[model samples]
Target: MSELPHNWVKTPLTNIASVEMGQSPDSRFYNLNGDGLPFFQGKAEFQTVYPEIRKWCSEPTKVVERGDILLSIRAPVGPTNIAPEKSCIGRGLAGIRSETGISQAYLYYFFKNIEPWLSEQGTGSTFAAVSGQFIREINCPVAPTSEQARIVAKLEELLSELDAGVAELKAAQIKLTQYRQSLLKAAVEGSLTADWRTKHKPAETGAQLLERILQERRARWEAKQLAKFADQGKAPPKDWQKKYPEPLEPDTTDLPELPHGWVWASVDQLSESVRNGLSKTPNTDQRGFPIFKINAVRPMIVNFLAIKHIEIDKSEASDCWVEVGDVLATRYNGSVDLLGVFAMVKDVPVRTLYPDKIIRMKPVTGAGLGKWMEVCGNVGLSRKHLVARVKTTAGQTGISGEDLKKTPIPLPSVEEQKYALAILEDRLQSILELELPLEMAFKQSTAQRQNILRAAFSGQLVLQNPDDEPASILLERIRAERAAKLELKKPSSRKAKVSV
Candidate 1:
């Protein structure tokens, strides 16, 4: 689509290369014994520049020679790799070899530049696939053989430098993740607020706070019992405690020590309740009650933009409705890292109900405590514990409500927690500022690589050499060579008469 050199010309790919679609051999002929030839089915065998040999075929069907460019034609559609050795190729791949006056490397880069277009051309009901004709018909900019060599050399030099920069940015990203984890570890371990604690004493110890929470819980349960009896217009049960048992205290054997005025507690002791959300699928009506799925639970906060609406009546779904400051966690995911990932609700645009894949918790102490718990659930020590408890089945990892409730949490005095949280927020914000730019640069490097390829293919990457032969002359030579080859393959008139 861009301007090209005066000596360059545009030509169909078939003019310079032979395209061949591969046919898969019978599965009975497939083997891993290194018997006949290495077999490549598709992208699964593809590496950076060449296909990695995994399985071998005892009875080979279609084959590609060494240095031939192999293209995946199914689903992914456009990744190209050079054949390192003669190999059997399956139906999911096609091979291209230079006919004359073309470099295999130049063709590889040309295909690389138009990968997006090739992917768009793919069509299939079950999975996207392209035919051999598609490859043959695709137009490519042709450069003189000498100019192509120069362009490829310059492109590789520039791309290698860009790739190195991207690698550095990725390394920095990994370090940033490690740093954030360290910051959370420090917050929960009491080391972050050790200096602050020395300057300002806590108003109340963690043990005293827990005692007050227990008393409040007992009183609230008793009040609920009285209200229920009043509503029924019946005498109170003589032994209502049997029906509504008090919550059990968690065992803290072998648990790690906490700072002075701090204690170890379970999620159940800290939260008013931990429960899973509605199990039914939501209706498509956008005006209906909004529902949050596992995807809505992002790091630190819930994402309300991608929410779906349920058709259930507002009054009927009230029990599963969530409010601000409630901590939400993914109850199950195909990835273990995503399982039990937590987020706290901030602002709601509409009344929202969480889906079954998410579990919601309301802290008994305060919203600040809920926020702290959400952070703890995602990082270091506590995260390792949670991951260890995850049960996996059929590729999905899950943690039950009871298991979540039993998660051990480090508790500091309310004042110290507030202090530590402020520090953690400031440090994490600094890390984010650093992270965002690195991520943007990584994206830019990818775009830069694509630009280099585009320029190289359009004959803009290297200057045209007037002394070099023009592409028009090279193409005429290739056409003449192909015509001679076709003449050689044609059957003689005498041989045809003898056969008759």
Candidate 2:
């Protein structure tokens, strides 16, 4: 603790405020019928005041008045909020009530400064918990009633400005994310690079490219089929001819017109092979086969640094192995919104995938190149398709393998697809670089404002008056009142317990 200047005083946190622990009512008896009072849990107090809570209790004894500060003590600790009204809270929260000498707002901000330390002191095997005793011992700075009011006023004014700037930065980030999605949607539909295409002569339509790729893949399969037949010196099966597939037809329902030399088709038509990843437990070897989970496959690029590895069985290596350029799609997940998420592998030290969860599709031909496929997967059209086909349950939702096979994709000319992807990457990167400094400015502004509040509340912000009553006199009066109360509560003598 630093030495106080003039009339400034320092005190323990418990000396200045009252602390109360929370308890949960029987949750089985909880109802949304609105007959009882609102109850808050740690999660509900993170930032927003949960106006309508799913849990409630009839016990009026647990009710807390408005202006009381609530802090969570479990799972996610340090989430703080002011009680909105007469409300009850769960065991996860500890309520702090301010005395006349302290401002609620001042204490709230002060708690924010100490929350990290409290979290560090939390102890538990399953989940961290901040005991009530630990909370009571936490220390903070306190000033006179008038000084508390001044600090609260100055903090509110400054915090409002910081909050406004943070809100704007967050909104800008959201808009940027939306714009990126829109750009991808437009690119795959040919609108983003259509101007360039209109000026150039048509070499081939997208349908023609798909047809050409189909022919190339069929020829490769047929050659392999014949080679096997010749090696056996036996007649090929009659149904084998029927088993051969026909050329894929363009799906006109795929919205937005395709550019010349581009086409639309079900994702199944482009892939010769498709299956889920491996399910075996992965080995933690530093240099081994690389395996990806659903999280590894993000929007456009696969994050290779997060790969896990497993000791490969020879058969698994021969059949289900992943290679560079293979596209993987998440099939089963609780988050239905992430059902159709796709990513292409760029480098692989080892072949890996979990069985029955992620679908691995190796394109028959080169039409599904890395750069173009990334744009196609994240494009707006694909997202709409994913939303429609994904399976949704009350608590969870996700896409299935069959749904993934039917995902509608726009085929772009190999040359134009490359160019469009390059432009999008450069433009998006530049926008992010331009916004980085604005983000920094917002952080610095808040820090400077907090310093102002600290100074004001500590009496350094405003000059003191020599004629005014000193804080020492106020302390004496408080001590006198406490002593008088203790004198009246002197306990009657009872038989003291001796060693058993």
Query: Any runs in candidate 2 off by more than 4 Å, and if so which?
Result: 1-12, 48-61, 216-262, 281-294, 307-323, 332-339, 346-358, 366-368, 392-396, 442-500
Worst 10 residues of 1 by lDDT: 242-251
- Pairs of residues at least 3 apart in sequence or in different chains that clash in candidate 1: none
* Residue 249 in model 2: lDDT: 43
Over 1-500, each residue of candidate 1 has an lDDT whose tens digit, in order, gives: 56778899998989999987999999999998899999999988898898888999999889999999999999789989999999899999998998767988889988888887787878999999988887898888999999989988997899789878888998999999998888888988888988987888787888887777767766767788899899999889788866765554555776677888888777777777788888878876676788886778866868887688877776778889888889898999877878888888877787789998899988876688888898888875667777988997676789877878878778888899888889888998999999999988988887888888988987778888899999999999999999999999998868544553
Question: Model 2, poorest ten-residue lDDT window?
Answer: 44-53
Q: Could you give candidate 2's per-residue lDDT for residues 175-269 as a string of tens digits?
A: 88787777777777777887878777556666777777677767777877888899999778877756676644434564766566777776677
Model number with the top lDDT: 1
Question: Which stretches of candidate 1 lie above 4 Å from their native place?
Answer: 18-100, 116-136, 217-236, 245-254, 283-287, 473-500
Q: What is the C-alpha RMSD of each candidate to the true structure, in Å?
A: 4.0, 5.5
